[model samples]
Target: LLETYCKASGQRINHEKSSIFFSEGCPQVRRDEVKQILNVHNESLSERYLGMPTDVGQSKMGTFKYLRDRVWEKVR
Candidate 1:
């Protein structure tokens, strides 16, 4: 389905850079199956986007330490 959509839209997906993130309670076998089907690798919650962890919940400020550090560095 993804391939078909990409073909129809003339857009190419870079599978090498793509990944699948499973929920905490997701079975390993099911996660593996999804990874295989999507042709993407597994990614941990620590994975970052734009220098910030992407999996942090809304109330988790510890994950934003990197952002704080960057701000401090800029302030100096």
Candidate 2:
């Protein structure tokens, strides 16, 4: 999902700095410009997942590991 999002958006996540709590990464597209796009979407993406529950026993650790790798890749 993250890969697809990154590819389609041309944005990369900086994992070395990104925490499980916050979404931090380079905006391939400009903030001012992207905000307009997001505004149109009305924050649906964040609203959908921001407070969703997760299962520690079932969720794969690799999901987060992959995000961390991508974050460093973009930062580099």
Candidate 3:
């Protein structure tokens, strides 16, 4: 389906750089199945996207730690 979409849209996707992120509490088996179906590796929920941390709902403090650190550094 993704390949078909890319071909129809004339957009090529770099699968090597692509990753699959699952919601919290997802079973490992299900995650593995999804990865196999999409041909992408399983990425940690803590991985950042566009400079902001992903899965912030899982750990608000951990996810925003980067921002807090930057703010502290600036204050110093």
Candidate 4:
């Protein structure tokens, strides 16, 4: 659908700037299939979304430490 829209509209999808977020319950096999369909072989996912961390796995604080550091820098 997105590819069709991009082609029709004459716009382009910068695959480097795209990331796919799957449900927690999604299996690895399914994820691989979806990636194959999307042709998103780039393993390096963008770590931030709109200036916030995306991969906040187990440690939200650890993942968001950069934000805190930025705030401190401005205050200092």
Can you write out model 3's per-residue Cα lDDT over 33-76, one digit (the tens) per residue? 88888888847554568888666676888878879999999999
Quantify all predictions' global Cα lDDT against the true fold: 0.81, 0.49, 0.81, 0.80
Error of 2 at 33 (Å): 35
Better of 1 and 4 by TM-score: 1
- lDDT (Cα, 0-100) at 28 in candidate 2: 34
Higher TM-score: candidate 1 or 2?
A: 1
Candidate 3 error regions (>4 Å): 58-76
RMSD of each: 3.1, 15.6, 3.8, 3.8
What TM-score quantifies how close candidate 3 is to the native fold?
A: 0.58
Error of 3 at 24 (Å): 2.7
Which digits, one per residue and each the tens of the lDDT, describe model 2 over residues 1-76?
6678999999986644342321346363554455453333222223224433332335656536666777899999
Instruction: Report the lDDT tens digits of candidate 1 across residue range 1-76.
Output: 9989998999998987787777789998988888888888846555777766777877677878778888999999
- Backbone atom clashes (below 3 Å) for every candidate: 0, 3, 0, 0
As for candidate 1, its clashing pairs are none
Candidate 4 pairs with clashing backbones? none
For residues 12-61, write the lDDT of model 4, one tens digit per residue: 97777666778779898998998888877554547777787767899988
Q: Sort the candidates on TM-score, descending order.
A: 1, 3, 4, 2
